[model samples]
Target: MLPFVLSAALLEVVPSGKVPSSIPTASSTATIPTVMITRGQEQTVTPDWSRLSFANLPAITQSGSLNGQKWSAGQPVEKLLTLGDFQDSFKLQDLNLYAIAVATQMPIKLVKLSQFKLLAGQTLADLALAVPELEQLPVSTVKPLSDLLKSAKPSYRLTEKTLPQLLEQDPTLGALSFQNFDLTGYTLDKLPGLIHAPLQAFRHWQEAKLTDIPGLREMPWQQFPNPPSDSSMSGVIQLPTTMSYRLGKDSTSISGSSALGYQIPCAGCTSITFSDPPALQKKRWISGLAQWVQGGISDVAQSTTHSEPTGRNVFGKAFKVVVTEVSPKQAQTALYFRFCQFQQQISCSPYAIGPVPFLSYRNGELMPVGNLEIGTDRSITPQMLPSVKQILPTIPTEIPSTVNHWSELLSQILEQIKALLHPPATPTA
Candidate 1:
């Protein structure tokens, strides 16, 4: 019936008096003696052991002859459990907890451990039925009990009503692992402590501010459909250079009907593919690519008519991207681009990049993917030239930008190619 309180101060609450020679001290080799609690009166004790001070445990029950050895309180609990009668007892979770408490030097009501053993694998409600004092246990005792029972108990479907009371009982439970928890209506201001839960553990938390979640800001942002309210293009990987593109059309020869067409046959235009695309709407890329081109081209005359997703089956599905630039000097340049879902079959082709890492565009530099080589002049065939010439004059001349001559554009492009193909020799002293 001794209370479970384990603190060095618990031993200091002795009746104020002169030191008893019978009681042990710091250097004494005397055996520890127990103090009896008188009915309706307080009992006092003092710590007189070495640095290792623990509560004076209640008297051992059923002493002697444990697994062919004399069982006593002096022996370690682990050895007693390992090679003692408690082997069966150790299997019980409640006893395991009591063993933990005893091992950790936490004061425990040893007499109650047997009762806990009887209720092992049973619910807290079941334990409360027998103990009645279970609810009244102090925080020190309750925490370990909660931890032991956490995995055993059925997952709690927490709601606004139940969450506060559960957290009030033990805030550490906020971090407990729960499968498929949904916090749809919660916000940081409303449940700040809930941040202890992992960001990925809960669902429908898109309502929460992205900045509020730790590590979320650093994740690679993909152009997925139905993004969170705070989602922005700033985090998406930017294409380093607009010059990454090359002019080449679909190489596949198709004789398919338009109504059932799966591939767009552009003999001399740009053909591109986005392999393993993220959950994205075509509009997101269209807007993103337009902004990228405008930003990269300051003297932009006009960027118009990026094609829609046609059932072009070159790789899988394709979208046409057309960017026509008219300079101040009446010279017009156009890029015909085809973007598609890169399929596995494309990998068999000699020109194919093994896997597409990323897709985005910027100004003045080629993209770093393996397949950019497909659109270079090396892939252009004689049949593509007439189609290229036919598409040239049809490009709109309305938009105007600072005009660089064709020769200058070609020279800069060649320099970029030369740098990629042949590195400058390292200077040595």
Candidate 2:
């Protein structure tokens, strides 16, 4: 074994170390490769700070780890690395250099991820390249690579038999939007593990369960021994369940078993993004969404004004529409009706037969409204006193001036007449 002086102590401002003194001893050209560090019997100290090419990288070789100290390239490796396709260990910080787009053009490849073996005292974070440009990796290396990265996707297209074990190590991996990935659909077999995992990335992965992946509804799911708490599953804006034993299922729809049901991601996807800085931002979004569903739309509807209602043909001079805030019960019922409408529209469930409401689009969704949104979030901008007279469903309310469905009103009147005409037959005596 030979001991060599590290290059950190050298000041090589003079292009490649090939030229000595204040001037050159060799032709200075960009194509000429400069070796940053040397190993073996040759005691050479060459340092050049000029345009480097991948043609000549560090002089360290695979056989140079003879001392068993896990010797990596010398300090000058950084100057050479920008040239691309490096094949050696790097300080944890330098790992990100591989992401520099210009550097990868060189024929040299980044570290061989397959043969990647950890050196003692080095954690995966040390080799974790934040912006990895590689597309695929060996299956066995996937976990280690996941540990190294704590995430993969958007940068790399990953696929595996399972949902990346790195998910158990760090659920944030699901936060990334993969360009394309061949992964397993969510299953009851895996859900419990994710529910109990400590990492939020696992929870995020669970959130992705809200997706309508094929065959997921058919998976056999029963209450787990350790079901996730409300806090764990809250950020999940919507989830699909063919299982009746869910956290807070609509029991009416869950007869002895669950009828198919699914909720989508929140209206604003940014709240669910993994890149969100605040850990609880996702949770806050769920809370806000629940409030919206429960008719606590907050200040998004305060700008309504002007009450001269006009509609003679369909509505006639029957009623005057008044602007008012929706109560929690009204909001909940509206969402329920909307959900039923969506279910029927998709042809996915058994709908409770009821008269459908006429609809309008106030915020992003179409629901029953009279020139206003029933339950919109704080993010919506309020509308002004424009003459926007949109038609609405025949509302069933106690409001004195409101109109009722003619057919329903006729049925009520007929029942009243029958009761008056046929008083209970005189009690027999």
Candidate 3:
């Protein structure tokens, strides 16, 4: 969704020593908002870079500029262009600025997004004030820019009611991809006739059923649809009934179904994995296909990972954790578990359950260790060596149907166990 800085190898816990206040406690997921510390940070950021055609472009340092504007790292884009500009313009930079430039009949430079807020009657006329070069353009030349800012009844939601009206005013809007459309969540009664439909359009829209869209057929499970063009809207989009993914012809693959009985994007998370890059590299590819779930599209999905154990060892072993997610018919039994040998990343697959291990700070990095043993009373104990037969059956793996509750429970337990494993050293006398 956003660019991530692969600032370090892994997040290491300071074992019973003087810990910097800036570093979070072993139990505290209260993460620093910094991009480098989060899990799958590099994975999250990779898709954005793919939008750029020119490789070897210098990084966006604090001193970077866009079209000669003094844009710096973390600068609020609104200071240069409205959200409308972002959604309509900058969002499509990879396509080159030609279409919008011609539409406005003025110089089309980079810009940034507006939301349903624009459905409230916002226009792009104020753009001249944001970009100094546009100040001298005639109102006539900029008329198309304003025309591009379409609006509907402020009262209309993104539903069957709103779609026809927007199309009635400008049917071409339907041709716009999901990324160009600002609003989401509601499903139209039918697919727009003019939609530039994909062979597998179901993978892109939320709440879409095969019956609702014309000229489509059932997608085979062997195919991995391309990642969604606008993954930022993932957290809000609907998924299909089944999906699958693979990075290459030979990579480890995964497939999942909605009939298994649990919701998707549970707690704004689906799956994660770990990997160790070469010692001198500054960035690494996140090693899982579920990162595609970063866009929140597709149902009946499958994910894949590297088959080999490819990361530094912890506790004399290298391994990876695969969290298998299923679709919801009912609330219980959301995801199952599998233990893949450790590699450089995490992945979510489908089917099966076993002991899910926890990570510990090792050699100045956080590494997955033995499983956390579960008690009959559901108490959790950290085990230096996992006893799968004894621990697996005891796992209260009956994850709650509600996402927030499950997230909260896991957060609380993880913090408690981490605190126990690496207690803060007592203050010096």
Summarize candidate 1's per-residue lDDT along 313-346 as a digit string, tens digits.
1111111122222122211111111111112311
TM-score of each: 0.19, 0.17, 0.17
| Candidate 3 local lDDT, 19-83, one digit each (tens) | 21221122321111112122332221111222221111121112222222333432322222321
Every candidate's lDDT: 0.23, 0.20, 0.23
* Quality of model 1 by C-alpha lDDT: 0.23
**Model 2 C-alpha lDDT versus the unseen true structure:** 0.20
Q: Which stretches in model 3 have alpha-carbon errors above 4 Å?
A: 1-125, 129-133, 140-429
Which sequence of candidate numbers ranks them by TM-score, best first? Answer: 1, 3, 2
TM-score, prediction 1: 0.19
Q: Residue by residue across 148-260, what tens digits does model 2's lDDT show? A: 33344336454452333444455665444322322222221221221112211111211121112112111111111111122211232222111111112111110000110
